[model samples]
Target: MKDHLSALVQKANLGDREALEQVLLKIKDLVYNLSLKMLLFPEDAKDATQEILIKVVTHLSTFNHKSQFKTWVYRIATNYLLNHKGKRSKEFAMPFKDYTDLIDLGHSNEVRYTKNEGELSLLEEEVKVSCTQGLLLCLNEIDRMVYILTDILGFNGVEGSEILGISSENYRQKLSRSRAKVRSFLNNKCGLVNPENPCRCTKKIDFLIDQKIVNPKDLRFAHFSDRSIDLVGRIDDLEKSVAIYRSTPNFPAPEELLEEIKTTLKIN
Candidate 1:
């Protein structure tokens, strides 16, 4: 795959429009997913991804071959997101602690008696998806990017460092701090991490449903049948816990969006 992408990059650099389009197609999902994770909103992520791709196409001729093409693309993405000045989603403004508290209060005996096991499971998945995405937002931009690259997306330290334009040591330090923060938050508040926690996804389902945060019939994250966070490969103890939340399947860029990008690039 790397060799094929390298060939595509070479052809793209040589002014082959078809190669350039293929290159964009290959990396479009990656760019969009990273933006979605970072921005925490679909529309914002879509806009950011589109902007970044345009920048990448405009600068394709300047890409030095010292790094892998994937790494270079990521560097473009990371830099774009770091400096992006856009309003964050309101969902991210609410503190995780406040979310937990709301769940605790909402999970009264009356609610528990009303919801069955299947309903509770569905709700838990929604909360897990929403809360995990929210947790990433809690980190500052750089830290958040580091955690997403290394922990979620499975980039190694060297590649992650290259993408962020930081030393490997610096990358490790940032990743450590980010991981620690997320781990602590989950252990304390997420029922998936600790059974003792009062914020079980099941308990929060009714509350989320009542507040319109989650709709039972039209579930968002819960209906993604292709992948779940559990599928992320874990290398060691550090990843064991983080993987639980980061294991969702890679989100694909919309087909129409890809076509729009292709047309904008004027590929025949």
Candidate 2:
């Protein structure tokens, strides 16, 4: 696939319209999924994905063949995410205790429940997704990106370093710190990490439902067809164990949006 994409990049740089479109299509999901994880909002992710694709298209000619085309594209996307000014406040930096406190505050109101097992399961999934995403956000930008690329997205150290314009050793060091931090937090606060942990997704379902953070009717993270991270094999190692929660579903770009991007680029 990388070789094919590199060939497409060669054609795209020469202004072959079909090749340009194909190139954009090839990386659309990657840009969107990364933006979604970083931004933690669908609309923001969509807008960012569009903007990143436009940048990629406009700058296609500057791409040298020294690196893989996909790596170049990822460099563009990751740089944009790291430096792009966000309209939304960075409210995700609070400590785990603070996050739970905020949730408890949201649970002040009393609400009735008539949810079935399926509905309850959906809510639990949402909680897990939301909390894990939140944990990612708590890390500093570089650490967060390293964790996302190496642990969550399953990129190797070399690829991750290339994407971020860093050394492989540096990427590994950052990843190690990130893993330790995440594992520590999960071990202390998440029941999935340790049965002895006081926090349980099941226990949070009512609070989330009452706060309308996890609506059965409007399921956010659970609606995607992509496999959940928890289904991955559980390892005894803490870093590997925590990685199970970091994996996210691939979020594909809508066909309509892809077409719109092609149109904007005036690609056939």
Candidate 3:
């Protein structure tokens, strides 16, 4: 697939409209999923994915074969996300201290029951996704990225360092610290990770719905597809706390975004 994408990249750099669109189709989901993980909101992720794809399209010629084309795309996407000052970025910016405090205070402690078991299961999935993604907001952008790439995505230190343009040693150090931080919180607080933990996704659904943090009518992350992080990557190899995140649904980029980009670039 990489070789095929490389062939398309060559054609795209030479201004082949069809090849360019094909290239966009290939990378859109990857960029969108990364943006979604980082931004935590579907709308914000869509906007970020659009910008990242545009960057990939406009900057196609600048991609020398020094790295894999996918790596180049990752570089551009990560650069934009790390520096992005979008609304969610500002809203979620806070220290771990404040974040943990919010988690402790946010729960209603009473589990809400739905008549249908399926409905209850869906709400539980919603809370699971929302809370875990929200936990990422506590880390600084760099740590968050490192944790996502190395821990959740199962990238090795060398590959992670290459993607982030940091030394492997530095990458390892950051991964260790970030992993420990996220893992510690999950171990102590998330019931999915530790059954003994007081916090349960089932118990939080009613409170989340009442507060409008989650809507049963419109779930953002649950039921997207059976395609999960574990299916895409090696989740079992990771620590249990981090492995819980692998159950998250991997969202696809909106198909219309590709057509809009083509229109903007006048590719057709």
| Candidate that scores best on lDDT | 3
lDDT of 2: 0.74
Residue-level lDDT tens digits of model 1 in 49-150: 988999998998888877788788899999999888446554454555664565456664345424576666666677668667867777778998999998
Ranking by TM-score: 3, 2, 1
RMSD of each: 3.3, 3.1, 2.6
By lDDT, the candidates rank as 3, 1, 2
Per-residue error at 26 for model 2, in Å?
A: 1.0
Candidate 1, residue 95: the lDDT equals 56
**Candidate 3 local lDDT, 1-268, one digit each (tens):** 8889999999998978889889998999989988888888888888899999999988899999878999899999999999985686567667878867766765655565475887877787777788888888788889889988877777889988999999999999888888889888988887767778888777778878887778899898877845342232355566667777776757888878888888887878
Question: Whose TM-score is higher: candidate 1's or candidate 2's?
Answer: 2
Give the runs in model 1 whose Cα sits over 4 Å from its true position: 85-91, 94-105, 108-123, 215-219, 225-240
Give the worst 10-residue stretch by lDDT in candidate 3: 225-234
Please estimate how well model 1 matches the true structure, expressed as its whole-model Cα lDDT: 0.76
Q: What local lDDT does model 3 show for residue 261? A: 83
lDDT of 2 by residue, 1-268 (tens): 8789989999878878888888888899989888877777666778888999999999989988898887888899999988764454164456656765754443322224544776555666777787677667677778888888877787999889988988889999999999888887776666676677667666666677776656767766876734353554354453544555544467676567788887786767
RMSD of 2: 3.1
